[model samples]
Target: MEPVNDIAQLVVNGLMSGAILAVPAIAFSLIFAVLQVSNFSVAAHIALGAYAAYVVNTVLGLPIVAAVAIAFVAAGVVGVASDHLALKPLRRHGPITVAIASMALNLVLENMLRFGFGNTVQALNIPVYRDWVLGGLHIAPQQFYNFLIAAAVMVALFCLLAFTSIGKAMRAVADNPVLADIKGIDPEFISRLAVFIGMGLAGIGGVLIALDAAIEPTVGFRVILPIFAAAVLGGLGNVAGAVAGALLVGVAEELSLLVLPVAYRSAIGFFAIIIALLFFPRGILGKR
Candidate 1:
C-alpha cells in the first residue's frame, strides 16, 4: 500500500480501537467526577466482565447479548460490593486514602481472578470475518460492529444523563455533592450507583477487547495504561473529554507504528500522559 493508504488504514483502525477504549475511559472519568477517586480496581472489573461473558458465551453456548448482560451485571455487582466493603470506610479519611485502598483492592481482585481462572488465554466464540477493502483501506467487520455498539452505548448514556431524573441527580452530585445533599439527594446511593455504572461500562469494554484479542487475567491490565491515558488526556473527571481523548490516543498510538517499533506501542500512552500534563493540564475538552 502507498503511504497515504497506510495512514488511512491506521486512522480507521485507531477509530475502531478508540471507540472501545472510550467506554472504560468514560467509566473512569464518571467515577472520578462523582467519587473523586481513581478506582484502579476498575481493571479487575474489566477482566471479571470478560470472564463472565466468556463462561456464558463459550461454556453455556449462550448468545452474545446474554453474555454481555451477564458481564455487566456480574462486574457491577462486584464493583459495588467491593467498594462498600473495602473503600467506603476510608472515604471520610481522604480521596488519597480511598485511592490507595482501591489499588490494593485491584490487586486482590485480579489475584482472585487468577486463582479461579488460572493464567491462560481465552478467546470469545465469535466468528471471524475477513477485512473489507475499500480504496486500499481494510476494515474488520468485528471491529466495525464493536465501534457501532460503542457509539450506541454512548448515545444511550447521553440520553440517560440528559433526560432521566437519576442522571440529573448524578450530575448534581458530580457538580456539587454538598449542594446535591442539601437538595435531598442521597450521596451514598449516588456513589453506589456511580460505581455500578462505571464498573459495568468497564466490563463492556472488556468484552469489546476480548472480541478481537485474547482474554486473560491480565487482559485489562494490558490496556490500563492506554485507558488511563485517555482519561487523563481528556480531563480526568470529564466524561465527554474521555471520548475525545480516546480517539486521539488511539490514533496517536497507531500512527506511532510508522516510526517506532511495534513492541514500543504502549509507550504512546506514557507520552500522551506527559504531553497532557505539560501542555494541557485541564485536557483538550476539559472545562477551563
Candidate 2:
C-alpha cells in the first residue's frame, strides 16, 4: 500500500508538472515548425509574461484571470514585433543568421526585464493555495487548473490546425513556403500569426508557473533547458509530440527523486535530451 501510494503520488505530480510544461513546449514547437529557428527569445517572452502578470495582479490588484489575459495579449504583441523587427529582416540570410539574431533579441529582453523588475524573486498573489485530496493523492488547486487549462489549449490548437483555413495555410507554409506562396498563401502573415499564438501560449505558461512558484528575471533561462529537452524529445516541430515529450520528461524528472538527489532532478531532462539526440534525432514522434 505504501509503495502504491508513493507511485500514485509521483505520477500525479509528474502529470501536473507536465501540464505546466506543455504550454512552453508547444510554443517552442510551433515556432520551430514554421520558422526553422529555435527562437531563443521565447525564454525572455516567458519571463516578461510572468512579470507582466505579476504587475497586473500584485501592483494593480487585479484578478488572476485578468492578469493572465493581459500577459497573453502583451506577449503576443511582442512576438509579432519580434518577427517584424528582428527575424523578418534575416529571412534571406538563412536559418543560422536568424537564430543568432533571436539569441541577441533574447539577451536584450532579459536585460530589459532585469532593469525594469530587478533581480528579486516574486510570486503571484492568487487567493487559491489549497489542495484537493482524492484517495491517497494530493493535488493543489492550481495544479489541477493547470492540467485542465493545458488540455483545453492543446485541444483548441488541434482544432485550429485541423479545421481552420489559416491553419491549413500555416501547415502548407511549413511544408513548403515557396510552394505555399505560389498557391496564394501568405507566408509572412502565417508566420506572424504562428508567433503570436506561440508567444500567447508562453505567456499563459509563465503566469501559471509564477502562480506555482516564485519567479525572477532568470526564471526564463532556468526553464528553457527543460522545455528545450521536451521539444527535442517529442520532435522539434510537432506540437502534439511536444506535449507527449513534456509528459515523459516530467514523469522522468519526478520519478528520479525516488533514487536521485532532488538537486539532480534537472539532470534527468538533460540526460533524456542527450540520449534522444543520439538514438532518435528526429525525436519520438518526429518524421524520419
Candidate 3:
C-alpha cells in the first residue's frame, strides 16, 4: 500500500472501531438524555459484559450469539441493580453529584471485577480468519463482523425509539419530563428502562472489543475516553450525535498514527472534548 492507501486503510479501520465505540456512546447518551445524569459506570458494565460473554463463550462453550445475549443481560441487570443500590438516591442531588457518584461507582464495580477475576487478561474463544485485501486495504473478517453487529444493534435501537410505544414514552420523558408526566408517562419506569438498555448496549460494545483485544478489568476504561468524547462531541444526550462523534473520533485516532505514536491515541478523546467545549459547547449536533 502506498502512503495514500495506508491512510485510507487507517480510516477504514478507524470507522470499524468507531462503530463499536458508538454502542457505548449511545448508551451514555441514553442514560444522560433520560436521567440527566452522567453514569460513568457504563465503563464497568462494559467490562462486565465482556467477562460475562467470556464465561458463556469460553467456559460454557456457547456460540457468539448466546454470548452476546448473556453479555447484554448480565451487564444490564447489574446496571439497574447498581443504580437502585447506589445512584438512585443521589439522582435528586443534580447531574454533577450523580456524575461524581457514578465515577465512584465505576471504581467500585471495576475493583469488584479485579477482585473476582484478578488482574489477568482473558480473550474470547473464537476462530480467527485472515484479513481480506481490497484495493490494497486490509480488512479483517472479525472487524467487519463486529461492524455489522454494531450496525444491526443501532438499527434495532432506532426502530424501537421511532416505532414502539414504550420507545415513544421514553423519548417523551427525555424531551420534557414534566409534560411526559402530565401525559401519564411513568418517569421512574422509563428511567430504569433507559439504564437497562443503555448499560446493555455498553456490554455489547465490550464484547465486540474483546473479540479483537483481551478482556480485562479496564477494557471499558481503555476506550471510555473515546466513548465519552463521542458522546460529548455528538452533543451530550443526543443519540445520533454519539454515533457521528464516534465515527469521527475513530477516524481521527487512526489517522493520528501518521504523526504520533500509538501510545498517544487515547489522548485524542481529551483533545476532542476540549475542542467541543471550546467551540461546540452544547455539542456539534446537540440542541441549542
- Sort by TM-score, best first: 3, 1, 2
TM-score of each: 0.97, 0.95, 0.98
lDDT of 3 by residue, 1-288 (tens): 489998999999999999999999999999999999889999999999999999999999999999999999999999999999999998778889999999999999999999989999899999999999988889999999999999999999999999999999999999999999999999999999999999999999989999999999999998899999999999999999999999999999999999999999988999999999999988889983
For each candidate, the alpha-carbon lDDT, in order, equals 0.91, 0.87, 0.94
Worst lDDT 10-window in candidate 1: 279-288
Runs off by more than 4 Å, candidate 1: none
lDDT of 2 by residue, 226-274 (tens): 8999999998998888999999888999998899999999898899899
Best-matching candidate per lDDT: 3
